[model samples]
Target chain A: MIGWTRRNAGDQSNSEAVIQLTNVDYTYQAGSPFAATALHDINIRIRKGTLVGIAGGTGSGKSTLLQLLNGLLLPTGGAVKVLDHTLLPNMQKPRLNALRRRIGLSFQFPEQHLFEDTVEKDLMFGPMNFGSSRKEAQSKAVEALKSMGLDEALLKRHPLTLSGGQMRKVAIASVLAAGPEIVMLDEPTATLDSAARRELIALLARLCREEGRTILMVTHRIEELMEVADEWIVMHEGRAVFQGDADELADRSEELDHWGVAVPEQLRCWAEWTARLPQLAALPLPRTAEDMARRIEEAVHGFEKCESTNIASKEGSQQESAQELNDQADSSMDAPYRHEKEVSACVTS
Target chain B: MRDKLIIGRMIPTGSRVHGLDPRSKITAMLLFTAALILSNGWPQLAALTILSILVLTATKIPAKTYLRALRPLRWLMLFVFLFQLIAGAGNGTVNLAAADPLLWSGTWGPFTLTSAVLSSALLAVSRMALLIVFTAMLTFTTTPSMLSRGVEGMLKPLSRKGTGAERFSLMMRLALRFIPALLEEAQTILKAQAARGADYEEMKLKEKARLLLSLLVPVTVGAFRRAEELTTSLEARGYRIGAPRTAYRQLIWRSADTWFTLLFALLPVGALLMRLTV
Candidate 1:
C-alpha cells in the first residue's frame, strides 16, 4: 500500500542520480517587453526511482521547474543535466530530444491532449513518434492501458466517450505508452473527485514502486503526495524554500501556510495531539490514518495498564467504569482501515 | 508569444481615459474611424495626427504600451503597405505610366517598383500605423466588460431588428475573454509534447503542423467543456439573452466625457473642412 520498494525482477536502474540541475534559471519571454524571471540559481537533484513531490503556490515557478527537468525549457542560466545529457544553453536539439524521450511529462489535465479518434491511436501516438514499429506500439498501448487499471476493450472506443475518471487514466496511460523512465506530472489530481484522486495516487505509486520509475509531481496540495512521496520540494517566490524527507516536511508544517501551501491534515492533527498529549511527543510521525489510530491505541493501552496497577493495589469501583469507558472508546474507534503505512508505533513499543 | 497580446488585457492606470463612459469611448472611436477615412491628403493627415497626439497625451499611458498593441499587427501592416505599393492602387500617380519622373526603378522577377510606389506605400503605412495606435488606445484604456457593454450600446439601435445583438455581443465577449486562457493551454500542451519527446524546437515543418493539428481536438473539446460550464453558471444565475435586467454597473456620462466626445468630433469635421478648402 505504501510506495517505495526496491525492484529486483527487472529494469532496476542503478543510477544514483537521474536528474540534476546546477544553478538553473528560467525567464519567461526573455528579452521581451513583458519578460519575467521565473527561477534563479535553482539547484536540485531528483533521486532515481522515487516519488518526489514539488509543492508551490500559483506562479511559484513549479511548472517552470518541471520544464527545465527535461529540455522542454533550456535554462536561461546554468545547466540541467538529465542522465548523461547535459542541457547547456547552446545544447543541440537532437540531444535534447533524446533526453526528453527518457522522461515523460504530463501536463495538468493531460486528457485534453487526447486528440486521436480512438484510445488505441492516442496511446500508440507517443511510442510511434519514438520510432516503435506498429506492432510493438500496439502491444505497448495495450500494456500501458492495462497497467493503468483500464480495460483493454477501451482501445477501440473514442476517448471522449469515456467517463471522466476513465479518460484521465487513459491520458496517463498514453504518457506511459512511450515507456519513459521518469514521469513528471503537473497537478495530476486536480479537479478529480476524492475517490478518483486516491486512485490516481495509487496508480502513480504503482508506477514508482512496481515498475521502478522516477516520478516528480507538481501539486499544490501536499497531503495526498506526502503519503506516497519519498522526498518533498517546496517552492516559494521563485526559490526552493525547503527540500527534505517527510519528517522534515512535517516539522515545517507550521510555516507552510505563510509560504502559500496547505499544511498536511495529518501533520496539523498530529501537532494538536502533541500539544495536548506531551508524553507522546517523542513518537514518530504517522503517514496514514491507521498509523495515527494505532499510535492512539498504544497510548490508551499504556494509560489503561497504569490504571489497572493502581486499581489492583487500591480500589475496584473506579476500575469498572474506566473499563466501560475503554470499551466505549474502542467501539467508537473500530472502523475499516486501508492499512497503508507499514510503520506502526504501537508495534514497535 | 502571449506576452504580446494586449487587446483584451487592460492596464489599470486609474487615468481619466479609463474613468470615461464606455458609450463615450465607443462614439469617439466611430468618429475617429470616419475621420480617418474622410481625411485623404497630407494636411488632413497631419491635423488628425496632431489630434491623435493630443488624445494620446490625455490618456497618460506610456507610449510603449500603445506601441505593444501594434506588435501583433506588424506583419498585417507590412502586407498592406506592400500590396498598396505593388497593386497600383491609391494615388493615381503611382502607376507605371506616371508623372513625377521615377526616382528609382527595380525589377524583381515580375514587377517593377518606382518612387510613386514608395510614396503610396508610405501613405498606406502611415494610415495603418495611425489606425492601430488609436484602436489600441481604446482597448488599453477600457476593460473588457466596458468593451462588451460599449459594443452592446453601439448595437442598441439594431435590437429592434431582432438580430439578437445581445447574444452576438455576449459571444464576442466570451471569445475575447478566452484568448489568453487558450494561449496558456497551448503553451501547456507544447510542454507536454516536449515531455513526450516531440522535440518541438527540432521538429520539421510537417512535424510541427501535425503536432498543432493533433491539439485541435483537445482545444475544441476544452472549449466545449468551458462553454457547458458557462451555460450552467449562467442558467444558475438566471441569465437570459432577452430578459429585462437592471444595470450592474451603470454607465454614466459626465461633462468631461462630453468634452472628450466633442474634441474627437472635431476630427471628421475638420477633415471635411480641410478637404473642401485646403
Candidate 2:
C-alpha cells in the first residue's frame, strides 16, 4: 500500500503533479568545504502520464534533477515532491526504497550497471527488491523485456554476453520491471545508433501513451524527443528556464542557444516556416517531418490559390498563365520523406 | 568518498612549500620518517612535532584540511593507541627496577595503569599522527605527475637502464591519476544501483556483499575500457615504452631545494645526537 495514491474528487489542484520541485536548490556535499551547488532555484511541475523531455548541456543539473526527484539525493534547500511523497532539505526521507520503486531512475550509460549472471536475474533484481515474489518477479521480468521490444529468449543469456544495444535495452528493462509509475531516464539514447535511438524513444513514448506512466527523460539532444515529448523542460545552468509544450518551445527557440542547448532542426525549420507564413502558427506545430511537409504544402497551395485569384481579378487575360503556374507548383511538390533535407536547407538558408 | 581522499590531490597555495622541487620533498619525507622512527623520548618527539607543525604552517593550507584528511583513520588511530597501551601495561619483561623509575602507578577496576605504559602509548599514537600528516603534506604540495617524476628521477641510478625506472614511474603516474577516476566511477555505479532499490546503506551485510559482488564486474570492465582508451591515446600521441622522452616541464633543482633537503636531514641527525647524549 506504500506509495499508492487514490483519486479524490475533492482534490484537483495537485492531483496531476506526478513530480514537482518548488524552489529546489541542490548542493552536493552540503556543509562541506567542497560543497557545490548543482541546481539553483529550480521549479518544475510534471503532470501524470506526460512524456517530459529534460534537455540541458553538460553539467546543467539535468542528472541531478532526476536524482532529486527519486530521493537519491535530498535537496540542500527547498522541496521535491514525487508522487505522494515530499522530500525537504533535511527531513527524514520517506521510505526511499518505496519511493524509488514508484519512481524508477535509469542513469546515464545504465547498461554499465547491468551485473547479474543472467539478463533475467538482472531484470528481476529491481522487482525482488520491491518485495515481489520470485515467480512474480520472473513474470515481471519477461513483461519488462517484452515491453522494451527485446526477445523473450534473451532472458536466459548473460547480460554481459548480449550485444551493446541488447544490453542497454535489458538494463532499461530492469528498471521497468519494478513497475514504476514514473520512469525517469537520463540520456537513454546516448551512445546508441540512430535507428536504435528512434526505436527506444518510440517504445518509451508507447509506455507513456499506453500505460499512462509519467516519463521524465534527460537528453542533451532535444531532436530525438521532439516528436514524442509532451512537455519540454530546458535547464540552463541549474535552473529550469523553460517548461512547456512543443509550440511554446518553438516560440522560444531563439533562446535555446543562450541556454547552451542546440535548437533541434525541426524546431529551427518550424521557426523559419512560421516566419515566412505567419498564419501557419495558428495550427498545432507539426511534430513529424511528414506532418510538417504536408502543412507546408497546404500553406503553399493556399498562397498559390490566393495569388491566382488576385491575378484573375486584375488581369483576366492571364488567368490561363496562373493555372499553368499552379500546375507547375503541384508537380514540384517534394515527397514528405525528403522534408528533413529540405528543412535543413531552409534552416541553413 | 572521493572528497575523503586527500592523497594524490594538490591544493596549491602558491607558497614556498608548493614551489619546492618534488625530489627534495620526497627526500625530506624519507628523512622525516627516519627521524620519526628514531625518536623515542619526549624531547625528541616534541622536537619532531614542532618541526612538522612549522613545515605544515609553511604550506599555508588550512589546519582543518589536514585534520579532515585524518578523519577516516580516527578509529585506526584509537585502536593502535589502545593496543599499545594494553601491551605496554601488560608486559612483564620491562626492567622497572633499573634505570628509569615509574612516574606513577595505579589500578582502576581490574586493569593496571602506569606512566611508562601511558607515555609509550602516547608516543606511538603521536608518531602515527605525525607520519600521516607528513605523508599528506608531500601529496598535498606535489601533483601526482610531479611526484612520479621525482620518484623516477630518484630511481634512475638504481636501474640497470632507464627503461625499468621509466616504466615503473609511468605505472605510478597512471595509478595516481586513475584512483580518483575509478572512485568516481564506483560512486556513480553505487548510485545507479541504489536507484534500482539496492540501497547499500540500508542493506544487510549479506545483501551488501552481494551488491559489491555485482559492482565488481562493471567497475572492472569500466577500468579495462578506460585502460584500453588510454593506451590507444598514448600510442596515438607516439608514446612508446623505454623510449627516451624529454620532459615538457623539466625539474629545476634550485639552491632552495638543496637547502630544503638539508633542513630535513637535520631531523634524523638531531634525533641520533640526542640518543647519543642520553
- Interface RMSD of the predictions, in order shown? 2.2, 1.3
Model 1 Cα lDDT, one tens digit per residue, A51-85 = 89999899899988888876777788998888788
Candidate 2 residue-wise lDDT, A1-349, digit = tens: 0112323324423447888889999988765456788999998888887788999888899999998988888899998888888999988755689889998989889999988889999999999988899999999999999999999999889888899999889999999999999999999999999889988998998898789898999998887887788789999889999998888998889999999999987777777777776778888776766556667656654555455565444444334443443344321123333434543444454
DockQ of each: 0.50, 0.73
Whole-model lDDT per candidate: 0.77, 0.83
Question: Which residue pairs clash within candidate 2?
Answer: none
Ten-residue stretch with the least lDDT total in model 1 chain A: A331-340
Q: Comparing to the true complex, what docking class would candidate 2 get? A: medium
DockQ agreement of candidate 1 with the native complex: 0.50
Q: In candidate 1, residue B200 scores what lDDT?
A: 65
lDDT of 2 by residue, B91-197 (tens): 53322223346888888887777887877777788889999999999988999999999999999999976588899999999998789999989988998888888
Error of 2 at A7 (Å): 19
TM-score of chain A of each: 0.84, 0.85
Total clashes for model 1? 0
lDDT score for residue A331 of model 1: 14
